[model samples]
Target: MLTINNLHARIEEKEILRGINLEIKPGEVHAIMGPNGSGKSTLASVLAGREDYEVTEGSVTFNGKDLLDLAPEKRAAEGIFLAFQYPVEIPGVTTINFLKTAINEIRKYNGQEPLDAAQFLKRMREKAKLVKIDDALLKRSLNEGFSGGEKKRNEIFQMAMLEPTLGLLDETDSGLDIDALRIVAEGVNQLRDGKRSFVVVTHYQRLLDYIVPDFVHVLYKGRIVKSGTKELALELEEKGYDWIKNEVDALEIA
Candidate 1:
C-alpha cells in the first residue's frame, strides 16, 4: 500500500532521514521503533506531507500514486491518517463539529456530496460508541482540558470516523494506561479490513502486545538498520535500544 525508496529528508539544514526504504502491503501492520532524534517522527511527518521537512532525496508512492506530490490536506483527502502523539486542543471548536467538517471536507474532495447533519451525526454516534467515547466529552471543545486517556480515545474516535486506507499512528500508546491502550487497539483492530493498513511508530513494546505487527523495523540514525517479525520487538524490549545502536555502529565501522 505504501513504498519508500531511498527516502532522505531534512529539516532546516540538518539532515534527518537518510536513505530509508520500506514497503508495506495492505492488511499488514508495521512497527517502527527507534530512540529519540533517530528520525522516527521525521519519517512520519514527511509521509503526512508536513512542510517543515525537506525531501532531499528518494521517493514515496502510496497505492500507486506519488505521495510527496500531494499537499497535506490532499494526503488526508486521499486516505492518509496520522494519529498525532500530542493532540492539540482547539478551545473553541466542539469535537462533533470538527469531525463533521473533516468528514464532509474529505467527502467533497472525493466528489461526493457533504453528509447532511442527520447523516453525519448518525455515523459519528456509531463510531463514538465503538471507540467508547463518552457523549459528554464529544460535546465539549476538541481536546481542551481532556485527560491523557481522553485525548487518545478521541484520536481513535476520529480514526473510526474517517476509515482511512492507511493509518500512521505516531506513538499512540504514549501516556495511555493499559486499559486505554486496550480500547485504542481494539478500535484500530475494528477498523482493520482486507484493504486497510497501518504503520505503528512507538518506543515501547508494550503497545505491540495489543496490536501485533506483521513486520517490525528497528530504525537507528535515520535509517532502518534491521527488519524482522514480531519477535524483533520483544527482543528489543528485553535488550533495550543500546544493543541495536551498538549493532548499527559496528555495521557502519565494518
Candidate 2:
C-alpha cells in the first residue's frame, strides 16, 4: 500500500531523515521504534506532508501515486490519517461539528457525496462507540478541557471515523494511561482488515504489546538501522536501544 525509497528530509538547514526506505503491504502493521532524536516522528511528519520538513531527495508512492507531490489535505483525501501525539483543542468547534466538516471535505475531495445529517450522526455514534467515547464528550468543544487520555482517544476516534486506507499513528500511546491505551488499541484492531495498513511510531515497546505489529523496525539517525519481527520489540524492551546504538557505532568505526 505504501513504498518509500531513499527518503531524505530536512527541517530548515538541519537534516532529520537521512534516507528511510520502507515498504508495507495492505493489512500489515509496522512499528517504528527508536530513542530520542532518531527521526521516528520525523518520518511520520514527512510522510503526512508536514510543510516544515522539506524533502531533498526521495519518493513516496501510495497506491500507485506520488504521495510526496500531494499537499497535506490531498494526502488525507487520499486515505491517509495521521494521529497526532498532542491533539489540539478548538474551543469553539464541537467534536461532532469538526468531524462532520472534515469528513465532508475528504468526501468532496474523493468525489463522493457528502453524508446527510442522519447518516453522519449514525456513523459518528457507531465510531464513537468503537472508541468508547461518550455522547456528552462529543457534545463538548473539540478536545477542550479533555484529559490527556481523552485527547488520545479522540484521535483514535477520528481515525475510526475517517476509515483511512493507511493510518499513520504518531506516538498515539504517548501520555495515555493503560485503560485509554487499551481502548484506542481495540479501536485500531477492529479496523485492521485486509484492505488497511498502519505505521505506528513510538519510543517504547509497551504500545506494541497491544498493537502487535507484523514487523518492528529500529530507526536510528534518520535511517532504518535494523528490521525484525515482533520479537524484536520484546528484545528492545529487555535490552534497550543502547545495543542498537553500539552496533551502529561499531559499524561506523569498522
Candidate 3:
C-alpha cells in the first residue's frame, strides 16, 4: 500500500532521515524500533507531509500516487492517518464537533455528501464504544485537560473514525501506562481489517507485545539496519540496542 525509497529528509541544516526504504503491503503491520534521536518519528512526519522536514531525496508512493507531492490535508484525504506522539489540545472545540467537521471535510474531498447530525451521531457512538471512550469525554473540549491515556485513546478513536488505509503511529506508547497501552492497542487492533496497514514507531517492545507487528525493523542513523519478524523485537528487548550499534559502527569503520 505504501512504498518508501531512499527517503532522506532534513529540518533546516541538520539532516535526520538519511536513507529510509520500506514497503508496506495491505493488511501488514510494521513496527519501527530505534533508540532516541534515530529519526523514527522523522520518517513518520515526512510520510505525513509535515512541512518542517523537507525531503532531500527519494520518493514515497501511496497507492501509485506521489505522496510527497501532496499537501498534509491532501495526504489525509488520500487515506493516511498520523497519530501524534503528543496530541494537541484544542480548547473551545468539542471532540464531537471537531471530528464531525473533519469527517464531513474528508467526505466533501471525495465528492460524497456530508453526514447529517443523526448519521454522524450514530457513527460517533459506534466508534466511541469500539474504543471504549466515554461519551462525556467527547462532549468536552478536544484533549483539554485529558490525561495521557485519554489523549492516546482519543487518537485511536480518530483513527477508527477515519478508517484510513494506512495508519502512522508515532510513539503512541510513550507515557502510557499498562492499562492505557492495552486499551489503545486493542482499539488499534480492531481497526486492522484485512486491507489496512500500519507503521508503528516506538522505542520499546512493550507496544509490540499488544500490537503484534508482522515485521519489526531496527532503525539507526536514519536508516533501516535490520528487518525481521516479531522475534526481532524480542531479541532487541533481551539484548538492547548497544549490540546493534556496535555492529553498525564496525561496518562503518571497516
Best by lDDT: 3
Compared with the true structure, what per-residue lDDT tens digits does model 3 show for residues 1-254?
Answer: 89999999999999999989999999999999989999999999999988999899999999999999999988999999999999999999999989988898899999999999999889898999877999999999999999999999999999998889999999999999989999999999999988999999999999999999999999999899999999999999999999999999999999
Local accuracy of candidate 2 as per-residue lDDT tens digits, 50-115: 999999998999999999999999999999999998889899999999999999999999889999
Candidate 1 local lDDT, 1-254, one digit each (tens):
89999999999999999999999998999999988888888889899998999999999999888999999988998999999999999999999989988998999999999988888889988998877999999999999999998998899899889889999999999999889999999898888887789999999999899889999998889999999999999999998999889988998899
lDDT of each: 0.92, 0.93, 0.94
Ranking by lDDT: 3, 2, 1
lDDT of 2 at 113: 98
State TM-scores per candidate: 0.97, 0.98, 0.99
- How many residue pairs clash (N, CA or C atoms closer than 3 angstroms) in each of the candidate models, in the order given? 0, 0, 0
lDDT of 1: 0.92
Quote the lDDT for 75 in model 3: 93
Cα distance off (Å), candidate 2, residue 102: 0.9
Q: Model 2, 201: alpha-carbon shift in Å? A: 0.6
